[model samples]
Target: MTFTGRPIRIAGASGSASDRRHAIAEFARHYPTDPVDVIIADFMSEFNMATFAGRRMDQAGNAMPAYDLSFLEALEPALGDIAKHGIKVAVNAGVCDTKGLFDVVSRMVQAKGLDLKVAYVTGDEVLPAIQNALSGGQSDFRNIYTGEKLADWDFEPIYAQCYLGGLGIAAALAEGADIVLCGRVSDASPVIGAAYWYHGWQRSDLDKLANAFVAGHLIECSNYVCGGNYTGFKSLEHGGDGWANIGYPIAEISAEGDVVITKQAHSTGGAVTVDTCTSQLLYEIQGPWYYNSDVTAIIDGIHFEQRGVNRVAVRGVRSGPPPPTTKVGITARGGFQAEAWWFLTGLDIEDKARMLEAQIRRLLAPSAEQFTSLKFDLLGSNLPDAKTQNRATVPLRIVAQARDEEALGPRKFVKPISDNIMQGYPGATFHLDMRQGFPRAVFEYYVTLLPQSSVQHQVHLPWKPTARTQVIDISPPPQTKTYPSRQPSQAATHTDQAVDLAKDFGPTIRGPLGWIVHGRSGDKGADANCGLWVRHRDEYLWLRGLLSIDTAHKLLGDDALQQPQLAIERFELPGLQAVHFLFRNLLDRGVGVTTTVDFLGKNVAEYLRSRHVDLPVRFLNRGKL
Candidate 1:
């Protein structure tokens, strides 16, 4: 079967099973009535093994695919429909050794004698390779697991693949594979791959592929790019349709691989503009190098031109050198940790933070034996020297780590915070919420070279085993859990948490306080009292805020509350009275709003005045405006 349309678009499903199924169904409903060409499902994460194994075993008995096989299994039910329309399905599931995966695919294709071609893309694990490059053979880097040098083994990897680019997928498609499987490829690989295959671009066609990859990246996270995380974006004026059912992003790729990232034409949300597209481009793309199944593109020149409201044309990107080595995963025993948090509310946010810090330090003084390490973070209004003229809530998070299991157990280190809630600070209230502790495993990694000839690609057909048949499972590596080293103490009780002042204000307001308000608007509309602020220029800017239990409950409730407006109002302090009024209103707003306050101030007076109506307001003049 061959693709006959403009290009095959593969949409990513949410990590959740239900969400993925819904996404697939939605894709099917919107696309051609008949199967277009290929439908690929990607289910990647450490926790998916159990889910995949359980589902497959229930369906096909004990003969189960590898742990990474969930990607394929998810689309198995759709196979008949896809095949009926002469389309194929591809999936990236399970963890297998990289070399092993390539070998398995190569062997399968040759044995089956099917008219299929295969290729392997690499470069996901670059940390080890970077380490190897930085260290010149003298001092080998120790695995986080074994604590031993990594050069003791004879393992070689073909593809030092990072989150890959579209080139490899294009290579596979060009080679004429009915199906393609990849490891550690970028979320946009399939989409970019389809574009390259359709355009028949070469590996050196960096400009075209990079443009296509950017478009793919914009829509890769499914919801985030399509206004899910867009700041200042309000609901549609007509109905709740915009927020209720957000449309997924789509890309229109030309024959030259120039891409336009947009949403369905009839969708309720607005189009993708330069601002929206730039925001998506910067999302989660750590540093300069962006990797895919093949090729590393240097995001040096990201130029965006608005074609339409929801359509953006991205161009001018460069390519980089592939890493010389591959990353190896190694797991070993670590230690354990436990943590607890409390809420502090009322007008004395700065004093509350100081008292809590002293109290926690005193608590640790008596029996520091129980914990190897201790940390404290003043969340919300409890932050040091926060300014507000209202009742603010501060949250205190305390974390403790121990070498032995017994010392780190929940009852030993975690229970003390809960036990001393009423004893520590007068207004301190401790909730029953305690973070559970678990064993930590450290994985040490190394980078080594493998001749390109060692890596092979093949396709496997499902059939009954022959007398000489030997079945080998091909899946990605298992994910390991790491333990936290230092956990902080709770800064405040639930009642004293801070609110975000910037987000609560109107767009017309401008000041340091307005800056604070704007900052909180992006931080999930947390209470102003439950946040921290820093004074710069003539304005008091809200830096960060912590979530309060009550506020969390309300925001996450079934009924939709106007959180965005609240954020706007809190941050938009019109004047001294507005600041005072906002703070006083926080107290009247009850535990829900007051429980999320946190602050950071230059001194105690500034902090107190920001939260007290009766206090004298002394505005700081820092030259210029």
Candidate 2:
């Protein structure tokens, strides 16, 4: 392998399973005319794993591929452009069935008379290995978040997938695979693999590999780095229309380990400015030390600088050896869940909610104990002296989860609530739709780690001449590091920042925290992270002082305080003028089983930004956003 010297332009076409399907076609369509070397799509997440598990359970041993069909549909239209321009494509849309997807794509390519070679990487599925370990009395599969032993889990695991590094992907690409399909490689693995193959970087090139790792992460979510979920939405023009036309991101990574993040030239909306890039950098990250299967990135020193329109230079990324072990997600059938909603109108909303809860509890008395989880929530408070009917009503939500569908079906869940309407509070009304009351299967997602050596990473591709398939085993990294379980202490930095803010800054005005700061939040399994940053260095000081873990818990209200695993860890990134918080177990059993209204915790940062804060009068005088 040899270095190309020229930078590789890798486009991020898909973020998740639900991302818009037009991106692949659009990127491919613009191809030769406006060249992009490669296109990568990420279609798996913890939530996706749970979704696939439920679907697998419903299939009952049906001989169907577990892969997401959207990827195939998206690629079918782009095949011509891909072939014409010789565009390399890599995606993790294969889910649990890489070979299935590989065969499908190969047939499609052959039918189209296209010369594209199709290959796949496998060995991510490890349920059999996990079962073997458990049978041998191995206890290494403890939950990464709660530290719970797998032996204590209530339900048996149905699926397990270890996150693989980019080496297997790189090997297939190096073997001249035009399209590389994968099963549960790390979300950033495609980009890492692309850069690895493009730059011909050795595994020992830690800094270069780390740079690709960070670049992969920044662009992995497609339009996210292009201001899709931006907190500073007001800055983007055309409002909703602008958002609908948001562009996807691309990383121009050089052999020297430098990267420039940008968007498609013809993108109708969204900008790739420093703030937008910073927002993506801070999202879904646990701390300054960001870990990938291939490299450990020290992001605390990283900085983003806007160079031109829709272009941001990423600099100062440092790296160390990757962790000895990689993460694995274990999924199990959590059982059935159902929910019902009732509206309380006008006066006595709290009393009405309390009465409804009591009535439902009494109605379920015979079998209530069978439920693994049950909760009633008042969604909102009724306004006083309101003119509109909608403003004066609060919603009462009842959610129940049980091991058996019978316990959550119409008789036990919906009928109990439906039978209470006439005996309920004045103007008591349930939602017109009752379908949500029907029980649906739910899966629990548990995250753990396994030694890299345990992964049997392999690449399946055809050799020349005979054109027969060959299985190439990819070894784990030659060198690895075991990071300390404990993180770097924040005591000194917290004390210094707190003291600076305590000193006089004159009078203060209470206002939304968003007035001076921007934030982004996301989930990692059951944990949620909120990253807040300011436009200027001065305001960052105040933000660091004000957003202590206690203050965050208060701003988060009862949800933060109510969770049994309510622990928050804070970290600071002075280079980016950002302060981030990681709320453990806040999403509750991950996205699959979480009953939180926010679901993936995407709204946590916005909620924190909406909270009123004692803003320095001096800062407020400058501008009021």
Candidate 3:
């Protein structure tokens, strides 16, 4: 094989199992003529794996491909097309069942009478290794979030897997495998691995691999790069409805490490623009250093350019050596938690909340004190003469969790309080269909690092008896300094002279910040990051001045709740005309423990952008949106 000047195209078929099965047809229809070299899908997340284990337990199933079949089902329509077009497929669809996934895919290919080579990369699972480590005193299995050792915990892990790098995937592809199935690898590894095979790039090619990593990162969420959850969705059409059947993203990485992001041909819905690319780029990111099992990609230097309509070139990505350890996702049972929401309408919302809480406490008097956690949230404020009925209605949500399943289970916990419904506060109503309100087991996620030497990466084919495993190289962890408490050191360089608050601008217009600025936010483990951007260059200066680190803190911070801006870090991307804010521990111990409706905090940016801010007439009139 010889290197080509043309870049190899990769079409992202789906983001998650939540994707519609018809998306496969969408990709198939376009891919026939366009001819992407490979198709990749990200079917699993941290939450997805635990959810899969629960589902498997519910079904009494003991097999692989148990985590999520939605991805495979989605691609069923395109399986023939994939084989016909000779399009390579790579996926992290395997959670605990790579063999099951591989069997199903191979059977499908055989049924079609297609000669496709199928293989799976394994050795990510370290359950036995974890036990050995614990026994041999090699690792502490300390929780990365809470810093608690797994040994002291009473719960046994339902699913434990360490994240793997792309090398195993690259190895399978290099061995001429048409499809490669992986379990618990990094989300971006599929694309990175495919690029590795096509370019024959070594694992140590940090800069080039970092470029591929960013490209993979950008497209891993599929339609996210195509404006599915973009903040500027409304403004993309400048206030008209243009979003419908949005196309998934397609990435091309040249042999020389050129990253171009685009979409399939003749797609009618969503768009791909610099703003959209920037929004997806910053999603689920912690800071400048984007660490992966393969490399530490420095995102600060990464830049983008809109090459043409729906095509953006990503470049200038720098990198450093990867950390010596791999992160292991240890999911164990955290007991049962259940929640119920009651609507308290009319006057005295706060009083009603208090009365309801008192009533519940009185009713659950015997069991309440025994609960590990009991909390109440009044969703709306008590105001005199509210303008709308929606505003007048406040949801009183009571959530309780317990280590004892029987104590918190349906009969013991839910019955006592649920039986006293009529005796509760007046005008109290409930959500009619609330199956989610029932007590269910909560899986706590404990992430910890395992030395790379502890993991064994290999490629296995059904026909081959000999598994091709990479030899291990040992080394002491590099003496690197990690500055956890250091805040970003950058100040506003330029301020507009004409935009004087009192002089040039006669009066300040009060409106939502979305009137001028656009943003995107997402949760990363327990923390969150929100990126704010502007279309007009003139608005950038004003936005930067208005949305300082202090302003971001003021918008997201709550002094009474004890959730302050103490851990918030702010960064700037002037080229994208965006400001990114990182909030540590923003979620109350993550989505599992958080009582808020937006548990993942995906809408945190919209929440902050909706806050009313004083905008100058100069900026507000620019959009007329």
Cα-based lDDT at residue 80, candidate 1: 36
Determine the backbone clash count of candidate 2. 0
lDDT of each: 0.43, 0.85, 0.75
Q: State which candidate has the highest lDDT.
A: 2
- Give the residue spans of candidate 1 off by over 4 A: 1-5, 15-21, 33-182, 235-240, 264-271, 286-293, 320-334, 361-372, 382-392, 435-625
- The candidate, 2 or 3, that scores higher on TM-score is 2
Tens digit per residue, CA lDDT, model 2, 179-289 = 999989998889999999988889999899888999999999998899889987777776433765888888999998889998987755887889998998988988877
Query: What shift in Å separates residue 29 of candidate 1 from its native position after superposition?
Result: 3.1
Counted clashes in each candidate structure:
124, 0, 1
Lowest-scoring 10 consecutive residues by lDDT in candidate 2?
488-497
Off-target runs (Cα >4 Å) in candidate 2 are 1-5, 57-64, 137-139, 238-241, 382-387, 463-469, 489-498
Per-residue lDDT tens digits for candidate 1, residues 5-47, read 4645444444322233454444444455322344444544222
**TM-score of model 1 (CA atoms):** 0.56
User: Measured by TM-score, how close is model 3 to the native structure?
Assistant: 0.89
Of models 1 and 2, which has the larger TM-score? 2
**TM-score of every prediction relative to native:** 0.56, 0.95, 0.89
The local lDDT score (0 to 100) that residue 623 gets in candidate 3 is 66
